[model samples]
Target: MEIPNDSPVNPEQVTSAQERGNPADMAQSGDFNNSNSKKKKAGAEAGTSRGNKSFSIKLAPATNLWTTQKNGAVKLRMEETCCGGVSPLTVAQMFQETVNQCGDHVAIGFKQTNQWETLTFAEYYGECRKAAKSFLKLGLERFHGVGILGFNSPEWLIANVGAVLAGGLAVGIYATNTPEACKYVAQHCEANILVVENAHQLKKILEIQNQLPHLKAIIQYKFALEVHQPNIYMWKAFMKIGEKIPDAKLDEIMDSQMANQCCTLIYTSGTTGIPKAVMLSQDNLTWTANTAGKMVDIKRAGRERVVSFLPMSHVAAQMMDIWIPMKFGAATYFADPDALKGSLVNTLKEVRPTAFLGVPRVWEKIEEKMKETSAESSTLKRKIAIWAKGIGLQAGYNNMYGNTSVPCGFALANSLVFKKVRVLLGLDNCTKYFTGAAPITKDTLEFFLSLGIPIFELYGMSESTGPHTVSQKNYFRITSCGKTMEGCKTKVDKPDELGTGEICFWGRNIFMGYLNMDEQTQEAIDKVGWLHSGDLGKFDEDDFLYITGRIKELIITAGGENIAPIPIEDSVKSKLPIISNAMLIGDKRKFLSMLLTLKCYTDDETGAPLDALAPASVVFCHKHECPATFVSEVLQKNDPLFQKAIQDGIDTVNRRATSNAQKVQKWIILEKDFSIIGGELGPTMKLRRGIVLKMYKDIIESLYVD
Candidate 1:
């Protein structure tokens, strides 16, 4: 388990940028301090010791790979904020703090039976303890991992914390994963217990249970069915087992936990190969929670709220929806995964959250909705909308350049048009909005910015816990992923002529390593402590990180011209409303070509496929808004109009290319869209290049022929 030291940066030299409001602000704001006091009072009133003491850990000092500079190359870390000198070491400890301070506050909210259901902090903590006790009663060993296959639900969060509270590691399995994928994770982690959401997930486990030799029990949370299996247990019955355990024993088990112990195993999406189980320790979780909480300026208890709709299996959702709230005492509203497809907009309207985190696709959908609304508006209203947006874009530029003063004219324009747009999108109350998980086009970012809503793009992976670089509210670049987070140092390893290199990181928030894959782990993390991110990127003059593309994904043409496909692909999709996806093809070929898929939309009223052709332009809809049943018959690649539209889009993208090698010389409109079920898209909705290229080998070859 020893990590070899390789070019470690001096600890004394590593420092984070000064945060907007320091500890003095917390002291000056009596409300902030009073909140903590109230939490302790509430715990005492509830007949429970809040355990307000800090859980400290001695972090190993590792050298940073880059030096601190204003612009040339990114080698910087942010200063850490002292929170009463008590850093939480484990998820259980972090929850204990919230229980003590905000025991009566709403911790989790979800819809059930057409009504909103909520769990208070005290009740949530109690359920976690019960789940932990049940694990102990079931003879689950310390450090043993439990697999959870489900969506974003209150039960999923409870089970995750419960397993960790019981001194066992929790492994989250993506609900969309095939049975074989689920079995691989269970076997690899030696999961002793499996918690599934419903019959659909339970069926997968049952089919592959024989392969999981170490799996001792299966627990179903909802949609319980009649089963006589000896190892299967209903949700209520599972809780009953914990009720029998003495409270003293549960407390002892929680107290025995350590900061460095591994608490969760997050499996990567496996875009390139079989997914790898990432081992994240208690320290990694807590450090990210604390740091990200400050970076986002999360509100004090009772005031902050966020909607949880993303997959719970992903690290971004886990950090934002679960762990960060535990650190800051924020409330998380869980949107039902099944209902999310039909009701995400309505849910956001109802929740009106203070903070929101979305992937690029989510933001793109919102942008499309705005465009559609504009197109449908009256002539004068449409004209006014365009005018207001222009003014807002100017204001956004001012804000990006650190101008605090707003122009009176721009403010007037915002009140006239932008304000209504914000309210309609359920973003009126959102103060902190972020987009990550994949590269977002500048068009999407600018669209939101021009509407007076700033979407900060961040950079990180599961290996970095959640985010390593984030955009600040006052200082942000539309093209960059903000600055390095506090207590974390970043470096561009072996920069090329343009200064682009592999993005490397070393910090307290970095993951311990991949589970049971020592060689792979060692390869990822060098002899020193730096974790080598396969993503290629560079830092701008302001130290804002810009991700170019993946090293493995770089395309070298037959003419020996190096080209980054992401930019070219992103450009085509951004400009062409009809194209759903654009995959560039040119490796070892004389000229570059592309594979394009038409966008599909379902009629809002009847849920039937809508015609792609419009009066003057083609309209594309979000992937989620399109039903799987209608995707196959929506568009024909051989149609003249479709082919002409796609060709025009490719020509437009080519016009912006710096060299001929980067432009698409030919393109084929695909009959079908890339899908997760088809193994063309990853869990995060990113294109699987190898799979796509292989699947259309004939089409690709045809493009190269005369």
Candidate 2:
């Protein structure tokens, strides 16, 4: 079925039966219509001054309307029930409330010295109090930013909350960032104090410390006692420094914090250029945590457990692992950094968290592992697995389309195969498994759904407090990022003929703006408070949003035909298991071309060879094993058989293209795959198109030379 891309269903268009006694119905039935018209008229009259103010043609209620303003901007105000009840003003208040309610409950858990360690809410709060006092003693002032560079740990969370309690801002530095990148963030935020996890992070700071005159001290969380340097305080000694100050002093600092004040500076992952510091206020954090929790129906008071492993510098990690847990008294287990590469599967099995948030790559790896494991079973077992999966897919589809009843043989299939798969994936107890940070292929989404695991795909950026829209339980679309959250407004600005346009937003969760970058900030948020997201997207009749591509990344051919490369790239990669990455090229050329990278056969960490094979070969072999010669020959770029496999994959993907312009006309398979260390991919695995284009300019030109 071809998906329709338009604004959400209008309240006026809704059937009477669906709208009966609904708030949306009440909004559309009265003077509200006239008021809306008047507002549009007023906006139109002042359109000249407003500049391109075009009011939306549909006039419905606030709950179901996408109202057009005089400035020609379309706006959809979400329903109010989406918003959560009264939330605390600041992180300090949230901490105090959680401590009072669940002081003895485990707040943070981690593995240390081959055994698990934990800290209770009361213990964590007490640590924060001491840290806040220490910061005060170190001359930290209101709104002064403190930089934390490390992996996820109890100390990282404590220092972050402590900074806020001390009336200061907490700035997280990505652990994978280069030393120069680290210096830029610390200098840009003017961090007064910097905290490092160990000598590795501390060394990065020391290399550039001379350039940071504002940095007064450096604290090491781990291996603190072994280090000796001027102005370098150990974690234990740092907390002791705060003990010298009276408890009343720390309380006074916490009391002075305001809801609207900025509490943290989260830098954007620098995929395109230098990272920009996003200032999220106390209100933004609390509101998002409370509101998103309600929308997803997350259990509170230590009932919910989640694995914390994603980079804390990312907003999603902060929102899920820190804010949501603190707000709802959910226990969070910090996954060990060392075990992340080799022991994640065992960790997930052991923890069996109720909620899991993973990027698309993580899910892809899990899916691959499942395939490998299942392939090792007997022929009969494999057939049963396949048969069970088909049944599960039908059940999942029924649920997605709002059919509550299960298929006749679904229970048997579940008990026989699906249940074991779920157990193996460590999702037996999981209620919510979310995938975000980048676009997930439809193939990946459906594969999990077929196993009775609904992996919800959400949409948001650092500017929107992590996620403003998410696919709800049993209410979702195949490729959509779901509907707007409560108290949030979204619109497609000046949509094209196909109804695709830049997605704009307005909500309390919108950021305070980039720190010390006023001109750029003004360019993002307009005078009326709407944040102009650079990404192009479309909305269906059901209000489900489908992100197409970035506005700047759109390719306009010489024939004047516009193309979105993401869907095409995703389609190509999904069809070819042997192809690791694909990038479309034809911005100002006659036709489309592609630059593809092949998959690696060796394990990234262990240096062991894997049984990676092309889809065609996999189907023929039936067994998981590939011939030794096949693996060796495929690694060579000039191998004819390997080239044939790549060409066949491209042909399959081209068959699905809606238009001739979307098909790849020419292509070249690169000798290497993109990696974060190579600067071709970002931390979240998003392609740095500009960088890739620049790096492969010669190769790209070669395809068009003919």
Candidate 3:
């Protein structure tokens, strides 16, 4: 799909910007030779070639959009080709195309008044346009921000698209962020408007309103306003503000949009330091959505459905829940605000979604819940399930190993057990199961596989527009992240003997750059224009990517041996079935140690870890002839039997360790499990290494003491 040649900016003017010695402009225009240092230019060419040699398509020329970075020095590094089969389109253009094709199809489903409420594609787009006009009437400026802090609701999406439609950047603030974090993002993005889901989120904004000088107004999309103030409006009242604004004015802004210009700001949930705003362009979102949808064979007939419950502030969630669905005209059902607490499965059953995505923690919870239910079955039923699972496991392995033949009795097993299991979990219709944003153990993968559900893993960061490599149907490995996308390129830079090195990416999916962070941007995208992912990984012979570790997370012992924590932690967990979390310590100490948290019951409403043991843990304890109910109870009593069992598991893990430095020499069990509320995990349930270290500093010091 060729872009029209009727661009308003003259090619001559863009050439002038490159000649003005602006480094960013030179990078975008592919004028590497014009650099002062010839060595730098040569390296850039070599790096570019190494990154894009696998792809054959010719890239479209950079347009005026490439030079339109008003707030920062961030610029897109020109690639040899656009994302394989996608045209460079703005968010508004993409939405319109879907609306034209599926006007009457259901676009969104939300629960209201104890019933599912529906919005057609045409109606969804119409509401967005109305919201856009209101944004203009409320003084949203070009290149400024419109911060939306809330759950995944129709209003959140509408406000997001509306901000872009009105020529402003859409900034999604995490609903879990504190008032200070909200202020940092709002102030950094120069937000002109803030949209909250309800009074709870509104209260946060109100506390920091004085610090956000650029914020002009606030809109509460849910619940009636209990406190009235100037420039604060309810959802209906806010939508009416732009009634006097002309459609032609909004249309002009839409027409002026370029795919390469920034439209969204995704702030990273940093493990340490302040969050940096990741500047994503219109092309980045649209190209990734189109190419990724094609990679996974997403249907465009409006027959696809998905459930949105993950935090929209995350790149993966936004791409899967909002961008991809919008691209394919799929209906998205908004799960309850407390969906992660326990309600997501109910929505999944009601929606019968065709595709589903979850973080590793979410999938792990599902696995545990299924195991709990299975334990209650009668002897005859248990025998039948065991028999069926054997066939399912073989069939699952057959597919993973590229064996097309189905195992004998597979059909019978599916009819008897797998089908029933899927129905019980509300996933009878789900064809794709995705897990990402954190490492998932092989045990969990196999557990789901035994139930005839294969969870494909995706690998990427916020900088890559969610996924750079995707494991999909007919192209997946059990423990490896699959091949790079069609139009993208991945380079394992400076590989050692094992071929593991930093995973670098080059493609249209790369972000424009961090908003207003020139130094950090330069550190990320090198002179060769490849975005350094900071991840350590190597590809197999089949080009399947295996993530070994991250540069920042690698532990270096006193003996100078480097070790990756994930593999060791995974090993410990696999050996100890009762362990919920295991963190490897001893980065600069004499020997490695670990911090372990036992599996325990969690609050169904708040998701906090309760004192009682989980069902699986309870069963494990009973089998060992040591009955324990709470984690605190075991620690308080210092149960010798339980301690021996845990030590036995650690010894088993040590037997598999490669060297003395890699083995855990000491260990301690935490009183509670790691969780989002405990401040040990991020919003997506990813481990926060820095936070964990600070919180348990004394415990760690004690382990190292003589």
TM-score of each predicted structure versus truth:
0.72, 0.70, 0.72
- Alpha-carbon runs more than 4 Å astray in model 1: 1-88, 554-706
lDDT of 1 by residue, 1-706 (tens): 1111221112122221111111333212111111233443432343245456764543323234221111111112223545323353667777777777777667776654444445567756766777788887877777777899987877788889999988788888988767877888889888889988778888989989999988888888876455549898766567657667877777777777766557888887553445777778777788788887887688767678788988888898899999988878787887757533456766666667789998876776677777887899899998888888887887898899988777667877888887777677666777898887767778888888888888998789898998999886866899799998867789999999999999998776777777777677777888776989898999988898999877667675543344678778888988786667789897756678889876665356643334443312233322223222333433423345545656776888877654455679887767666666667888897899989989999989999676
Off by over 4 Å in 3: 1-85, 554-706
Model 3, 453-562: lDDT tens per residue? 99998988888999999988789988888889889999999999999999999888888777777777788888767889888999999999998877777675543344
- State the C-alpha lDDT per candidate: 0.71, 0.71, 0.78
For model 2, the stretches where C-alpha displacement exceeds 4 angstroms are 1-88, 224-227, 554-706
Every model's Cα RMSD, please? 16.2, 19.5, 17.9
For candidate 2, give the lDDT of residue 80. Answer: 48
Candidate 1 — worst ten consecutive residues by lDDT sum?
A: 67-76
Q: For each predicted model, how many residue pairs clash, with residues at least 3 apart or on different chains?
A: 12, 9, 2
- As for candidate 2, its clashing pairs are 43-70, 52-71, 53-70, 53-71, 53-72, 54-71, 54-72, 55-68, 56-68
lDDT against true structure, model 3: 0.78
TM-score head-to-head 1 vs 2, winner: 1
